[model samples]
Target: MMPASSATLHVVATPIGNLGDLSPRAQEVLRTVAAICAEDTRHTGQLLSQFGIATPLLALHDHNEEAIAGRLVARLLAGESLALVSDAGTPLVSDPGFRLVRAARAAGVRVSPVPGACAAIAALSVAGLPSDRFVFEGFLPAKAAARRERLQRLAGETGTLVFYESSHRIADSLADMVQAFGAARPAVVARELTKLFETVLDGDLEALLAAVQADGNQRKGEFVVMVQGAGDDEDAKVAEGRRLYARLNEHLPPSTAAKLAADLSGAPRKALYGG
Candidate 1:
């Protein structure tokens, strides 16, 4: 049982796709709170109606969050327990409500969490990729050039790379990923997780790209794309060799820099010098 406090703000997690995934505690928080702050009031209203919860909802999305946060915090400070929820999944994980949560904490109001389903976690669990240490990069840039540039920067990541992609751009994004990270790099595309037609496809980047392109149905839903990180040994050699080459080149001839860098980084001198 949640301890009822004087001025409490509950950060509740809601179901992403399957309504059954909503936890009992989260439902209780939504039901008992003085009001629920929602990213989309209409969407939340439907969910509450389904559960027979009659709690009043206050809209607090990205656009109006800054403007409304002060008023919501005042309500919390006035001894009204408030619950914060997003359109789906956990609040503030690629969703809105950060301002209000920050305001409530800064004002000394107690904030509690009601954990539940998250799309990224759901996808990662079934991605067949390394999950011990991973990074959740919410969404990639929309433009082709920018997206590829970002992927290029993340090519050397040592932990699994997770990203959320829309149905429209999933194909293009996967193609760019294949170019940025080598075609042989292992990757997975988890689509429409926890919902009907859920699909988790794993293979090398080239194969996954081909699969997504060939099957139009595969590109019709929300996606969580996971790419295997660079191998530690090769990544370290290339990265360290480049770094040493850059510094040594400033003080010595190109050949000498390449040789010294190769010796220090255990990388071939010809490879480091583009021979």
Candidate 2:
């Protein structure tokens, strides 16, 4: 056996949907840890109950983090090993365990990762969307105006964009994406994930929007939305500028429109002006 100086925090990844995905080692660790810190103690409690793990649980979430980290670290310092878990996926990822993980590390406590399912990665795997180079944008701002602005900011991101969204707002958000990213942009929507009704719908921005509208349940669960990266063709990029310049012909002046269109469409300002 190895030597033990003191206790450390274990950052574990819980199943996103399928309970069967929980690894055996993770199960054992959860059962024996001095305590378990979870985003929602009740939810984690249920998961632990399923596995017959009786470890004590501490509720650690966004609202209570600052007040909790100090005491949690002290417990770790006192040789109380703990496990940190989000409601789903890896801890500290769009979840509320960042402060504890950071504090534990700062205090020289050992940190171990128990890797498992992540909704974003899981969605990407089955989405048929670009995965070589991608970014996970946890969730966008909720306001329609703010969300649209955010979508505008990411209009031409080169890598495929992935974001988590609530079912209630998925339709509106997709519509905004259509406005900012274009209706014809290829996209995919993965719903419910690894659950019994897991669904993945693929289409352009508009087509997916329509499909979600037609099927009432399309907007009924956690959603992982993936938007394709900008087309790589230099000529196509130039053509995009031309199209935007045409739009600017109505809303703005030539020079101003050229800059705006270039920024939005990622085209050459000079080429847009020339066209």
Candidate 3:
């Protein structure tokens, strides 16, 4: 049983893929939270069914967070303990629990975290990419042009770059990644981690793209793409920039080289061929 003093909001993390990763403490909180604000009740229901947790769940997804935020706030203020759980992984890491979390905090309610499995961290675990400093670009823009623009902006960032891509757009996303991040940039596509049919393909963008293209089997499952950061070596950096310039110049003007080069180099736009 959770402590009486712990009658507070708990942001719990459930299993990312494998149910076994769910922590005892997290489960304890889950079983005892007076109520739970789930991104999707049906989805959370399946999870709760595993542990026989019968706590009532409130659906508080993107579309409904604002509508339900006030009631949730009032409940928490009345000293009713609640747990917030996403369909999977840590709550609020790309989920809709932020408003409630913020409201709880604003109301001077104690908020505790029951941390556990996180998809980004799960993918990063075996991605073989640098873990030092990474950025999570959660689920790219659905539109190709917007997605490509976003990809182009992060091409040569000097830290591991992580992106969540869906199966339907994975091919197109990978293709844009090749254009921006480059064909030779080292990357890893981790999917279904800790679940059946788990696959991790680590290779340069071109090879990974080709591998994904060649096999119908490789195209399934949720994905996390981890790209290695830019390396040192002034000339090598320029070469990477030249590659991007080559692609851009084909469909753009010479003046466009600076923008393309900047995207492929961590260097300043002005420094890259002096703008």
* lDDT against the true structure, each candidate: 0.86, 0.85, 0.82
Please state the error at residue 186 of candidate 3 in Å: 0.3
Q: Which candidate is the best by lDDT?
A: 1
On TM-score, the candidate that comes out on top is 2
lDDT per residue (tens digit) for residues 116-224 in model 2: 9889889999889778999789999999878866776666577889999998899999998886777888999999998989999999999999999899989898999
Candidate 3: global Cα-lDDT?
0.82
Native-to-model Cα distance after best TM-score fit, residue 210 in candidate 1, in Å:
0.6
By TM-score: ranked, best first: 2, 3, 1
Worst 10 residues of 1 by lDDT: 1-10
Q: Which stretches of candidate 2 lie over 4 Å from their true place?
A: 1-5, 233-275
lDDT of 2: 0.85
What TM-score does candidate 3 get on C-alpha atoms? 0.86
Give the per-residue lDDT digits (tens) of candidate 3, residues 151-245.
76676577888988888888889998887766888999998778899999999999999999999878898888998876656534654565566
Better of 1 and 3 by TM-score: 3
Pairs that collide in candidate 2 are: none
Q: Superposing all C-alpha atoms, what RMSD in Å does each candidate have to the true structure?
A: 4.6, 4.0, 4.6
